[model samples]
Target: MNLSIFFEPLPEALFGGDDNPKSVGGYIAPFLHSFPDWRSAEVVLIGLPEYRGTAGASEISFQGPNLIRKELYQLMKGTGPWLVMDLGNLLPGIHLEDTYLRLKEVVEMLVDEGKFPILLGGSHDLTYGQFLGYEHLNKTVSLAIVDSQLDMQENKDAAPDQSHLHRLLLHEPNYLFSFSQLGYQAYLTPTTTLAALEKLHFELFRIGQVRQQLKEMEPVIRQADLLSFDVSAIKHQDAPGQQHANPFGLTGEEACQICWYAGQSDQLSSFGLYGYRPEFDHRALTATTLATMVWYTIEGFYQRLRNLDFQSNNFLRFSVGFHDNPNKMIFYKNRQTDKWWMQVDDLSGQRPPMVVPCSYQDYLTAVDGEVPNRWILTQARI
Candidate 1:
C-alpha cells in the first residue's frame, strides 16, 4: 500500500528546530525530507483530520494535527533508539463510512507490517475505524477507551457522536473480547448506557475511582490490544481545545500516567488520541499536554522488558492459597521493572496458564484470601 496517496506532507509552520540535533523535530526531519521505508520504521505517525461523525462539532478547522506537531517538535529527543515517520493528514472520504473504511485500511496495513501507528484524531468516533482494522487479522481484541462519557447511544441519527459505540458493540463478525472505559464522569454517562455496559460485562471506571486507584487501573489498560483516548476525558482546564470537554475529567498528569502504562504493556499493539480542536483552543495548552503525553508514552515504550520467559531468574514467582478453596493463586514479579503479573489456569485446556499483567496491590489482595476484582474480570472475559 502506498501510504503517500492517502496522506500529504505536513505544513512548514509545524516544523520546529530542524537545525538543532537535540530536538525531536531534528530527529524526525530525515523521514519528512524523503519518505522513509515503512518496513524499516518502528513507529509511524498519522493524522486523521476527520470530524464527520461528531454532532455539533462535526466539521473541524483542520488545524489540530499541525497544532500538535508544533508542540511535539519542541520536545527534546530521548536517548532510546526510535525510528519515526510522520505521514501527514489523511484525505477525508466523501461519506462518513468511506472515511472509516480508509482509516481501517491504513491501520490494518500498518499493524500487519509490524509498525505501531500513533493516530491523531479528528473526532473520537474515528476509534471505530481503528477497531475495525483489527478484524482483518482475525484476532480477538481487548480495547480500552478513555473518555468522560460513554459514546454509545441508540439514536441512529446522531451516528458519529452518540452512536459509534452502538455500532461497534452490535456489528457482526465481532472480534471484541473485552472493552473498558476509563475516566468517565458519572453524571455525563446515561443510565441505560451504564446498565448496558454492566449487562455486557464490560469494565467501566469513573473518574473519581480512577483518580484514587491508578495502580489498579494499570492492569486494565494492559489488557488492551488497542487504546483510543478522547481528549475530552481530561478536565477542560487541561484540554480546553476539545469540542466536548468536561470540567470534571482526568487531570493532565493522570492522563499521561495512563499513556505511560499503555506504552509499557507487551500486549498493546496500537494507540490513538482523538478530539482535539485547534480553533476552540485559547492558548494551545491542549497541544502541549498532548505532546507531553506522547513523550511519556515513548519513554515507557523504551522501558519495556524484552524477556517474557517466566522461568528466567529475571522474575520471582509466588503462590497464595485461600483457606476456603484448595486452588492456589500464583503471581510473578519482574525483578528488572518491579512489575507484577498473575497466572490464571486456562479452564478450556487449549492453552497454558494465562500470564496477566497485575500489580503488587492485587497480590496483597490475594494474600488476604480475597480474589482481586481484576482476576475475576479477566477470568470472565477469557
Candidate 2:
C-alpha cells in the first residue's frame, strides 16, 4: 500500500530548526521533502491530528500533534541505533468514518510488516480505528486501554469519543479475545456499564486498585496485542491538555511506567496515545509529560527479552495440585525477567488450554490451594 498519500509532511517550523546529535530528532527520519522508507524501521511514529471524533472540532486541536513532537524531538535519544520514522500527520478523509478507515489501513499495513506503530495525538475515539487494524490478522486479540472513565455511553447518538467502547464491544467479525481497562475511576464510571463488562468476563481495574499495586498492572499490559491510552487518564494537574481531564487520575510518572510495561511486551505491536488538545494545555507541560512517556516506551522496546519459549532454559516451570480439583495448575516463570504465566484449561473444549500472563501473587495464590481470579476469568472466557 502507498501510505504516503494518506499523510502530509510535518511543518518545517515544527522541527525547531536544529537536530542535535544527542536528541531524538537527530535519530528519527521525519517525512519532509519525501516519505521516508518505513520498511526497514522497527518502530514507526505516526501523528494523528484528526479531532472530528470529539464533541466539537477546534482549529487549535490540529496543532496538538506538532506540540507533542516539538517536545519529543528535544529529548535525548535512548540506547539504540534507533530504527524510528516519523510518518508525519495523517490526513483525515472527507468523512469521519473515512478517517477511521485510513487509520485502520495504515496500522494494519505497518503491523503486518512487523513494525510497531506509535500513534500520537488524536481524540480517544480513534482507538476504534486502532482496534480495527487487527481485523485481518486471522487471530483473536487482547486490548488494554488506560482511561479514567469507561467510554461506553448507552446513547447510540453520542459522539464517537463517548460511545466508541460501546461500538467496539458490538463490532462485527468479533476478533477481540479479551479486553482490560486500567485506571478507571469509580466515581466517573457508571455502575451499569461496569456490570456489563464484568458480565462479559472482561477485566476492569479501578484507578485506586491500580495505584495501590501498580506492578500488578504489568501482567495485564503484557497480555495485550495493542494498547490505547487516553490523556484524560492522567491527573488534570499533570496533564490538563485533554477536554476530559480530571483532578484525580494517574500521575505523570505512573503513566510513563505503564507505557514502559507496554513497550516491553513481545505480544504488543501497536500503541496509541490520544485525547491531547494543545488549546487546553498549560505551558506545554502535558506535551513534555507525553514526550517523556514516549521516551520510556522506546527505552523499554530496546530492553525486550523475547522470552516466549516456555521450554527454554530461561524459564522455570512449576505445577500446583489442588486436592479438591482434578486439574493441576501449571505456571512458568521467566528467569531473566521474573515474569509469570499460567495455563488454564479451556472448558469450551474447542481448542487447547491457553497460557496467559499472570503475576507472582497469582502463583502464590495457587500454592495456597486456591485458584487465582485471573485463572477463573480466563477459563470463563474460554
- RMSD (CA, Å), each prediction: 1.8, 1.2
Error of 2 at 108 (Å): 0.6
Error of 1 at 133 (Å): 1.4
lDDT of 1 at 19: 67
> Best-fitting candidate, measured by lDDT?
2
Stretches of candidate 2 off by over 4 Å are none
TM-score of each: 0.95, 0.98
Q: Which stretches of candidate 1 lie over 4 Å from their true place?
A: 30-34, 57-59, 348-351
Ten-residue stretch with the least lDDT total in model 2: 11-20
Residue 62 error, candidate 1, Å:
0.8
- Report the C-alpha lDDT of model 1 over 33-57, residue by residue, as the tens digit: 5455777877777888888777665
Could you tell me the lDDT of residue 127 within candidate 2? 96
